[model samples]
Target: MENIAKVCSRLIFLSVICLFFAQAIIADKPDFKYSFGCLDKGDYTSNSTYKANLNHLLSTLTSNTEIDYGFYNSSYGRDPDKVYAIGLCRGDVKPDECRSCLYNTTNFLIQHCPNQKEAMRQDEYCILRYSFCNIFGIMDDDPVYTQHNVNDQSGNLDTYNQDLRTLLDGLRNQAAAGGSLRKLAEAKSTGINNKTQYTLVQCTPDLSQTDCSDCLLSAFGQIPLCCDGKIGAVIFTPSCNFRYEEHTFFGPVADVAPPSTNTSVADIAPPSINTSAAKGNDGNKSQTVIIVGSIIAFVVVVVLIIISCIYLRVRKPREKSESKLINWFIVKKV
Candidate 1:
């Protein structure tokens, strides 16, 4: 019994230690998924001039100095071998993540879309596109790729979709009207069941306002075809991309409050007092609350695991002893 108790205790301790290390490993890694479009305009040979242009363009896009605004566009080589590539990162993505995303995407494009004259890849944090023709300052919405969460919306989907559309429309206009260096917008809205929906809209910075708007609108038109009735979805294309989900998936940025909708102005009114000075204070309070809540949750989980370990250790021996007793009785009778 003493030996079993020691072994069980060691096993439990090792399990808890393993769980901590596993969680740490998972937290350090970023989960990224990407989709790409490859144009069949023409194929290049392994050692062709086009491949050289593509390599040069990708390197330029991912250069350390060119990632400040998280958008880069450049052309390489000449004539038919020329490759025009564009890299655009989500507005709220950190500079390091932006660079990593672009670099990973470049490698993916080369490997998966090999020998293609035109190819584009879209990840959650960034986009990478390369083409033989002039892709700069132009909007191309064709050949879109749409993805949606597997879960369907509950409650009134009409109300949910209406709120989603309104939120995305405002973000679309705001993003398209952005300055030349960056065209991106993120916002949130309250929908049915008091759920918060976060939406991100973005276009390549090289596109003109009109072109960007048109491209986004075209992408929006496909929501019904791909994302209607879903709780979350992403519509991606070479020119633009839009995403929305119930959870706040992005870090804090210059996000606009949702427009005053069917509710009264008083419902959304600001406090009469000057709260600007308290904004930092309020942020600190929120952070403190989150930290405290996390600690509480962690403690609860640890306690539950310990209880489980004790219960298993106590019960396992009883079951084993009962099985041995039954076996011994049967052998004596035989």
Candidate 2:
């Protein structure tokens, strides 16, 4: 009995150690979500100055605390040996996850693309890219990479396509209109058989609205060739990208209020209002009252119109039935 107890205690201790190590290994492991392009633009020797600059630039990418919004663009070195890098994370990704993704993806790209002067790698959460040329603010839609689920959508293709297109188009517009920090939108729509189609669209915030729109539109145009009726798909470009699936694949999004339309003169007044605190407060209160009253009046008018239309519609059907019965009686008498 003493020997048996010793053996059992040993086994339990060993199991606890094994469990701890297993969890550690899992936590440290990188997610191998690899989709990359080692472009044919150019290559550098192992000891080249460009390689050193590239290393330095990429090293700064993940370490910078100022890039909490998830877009990083920076350059190192000068003239012929300069390197430019861009690291972008999905809008819904938290800052720590974004940094971790960029770190892993940068390491993966370095291993895979070696001495290439231009290379781009995309994982599930982020995109890491470095180029010999200036890639900021400019839109590049070529060399689009796409991935899709093997299972095809089991529904009406036309209806599915229409629903996906509508969702993507709206998301594109919303993302394009985003500010310089981040340009991204996620939404869901009911498709064929009432399945909810989840979608995310995004652009590099550096791109102008027109450029972003064009880049996303170009990505949208590739769905036919790449994903067709797949239940899920992701299309990637340097400037913009989009993804869609039948199931939710993104995190919660913070709601953004629509731009207010009350643009009275006082609302746009000069900065001198800070000097006149009492006047400014009064002006703000007046504007608030006017805006609230306007909204109430608009709602009242719309409600009255809707009630009148409903009454007319219901009365019209009854009047038509009564007239038909009267006409039939008159014909019978004749």
Tens digit of lDDT per residue, candidate 1, span 1-334? 6765776677668767866775564343223357787878889998998898788778766664523556667777889688787788777765566778899998898999988888888887788888888887889997898888766888998888788888888888998998665688888778889887878899986689999999999999998998789888888888899888776656654332322234321112211221111011234245446755765676677677678778777888999999999999999999
Candidate 2 structure quality by residue, lDDT tens digits, 1-334? 3554555556556655655665454333222345899999989999999999999888876665534566777788887998888888877776677788899888888999997999998777789888988887889997888888666888789988887888888999999999665689888777888888878999987788989999999999999999898888889998888988765566654433332354321112111111111111233235446755765665565566556556666776789899999999999999
Minimum summed lDDT over a 10-residue window in model 1 is located at: 271-280
Pairs that collide, model 1: none
Show how many residue pairs clash in every candidate, following the order shown: 0, 0
Candidates in order: C-alpha RMSD to true structure: 12.5, 26.6
Candidate 2 contains a number of clashing pairs equal to 0
RMSD of 2: 26.6
List candidate 2 stretches off by more than 4 Å: 1-33, 254-334
For model 1 the TM-score comes to: 0.69
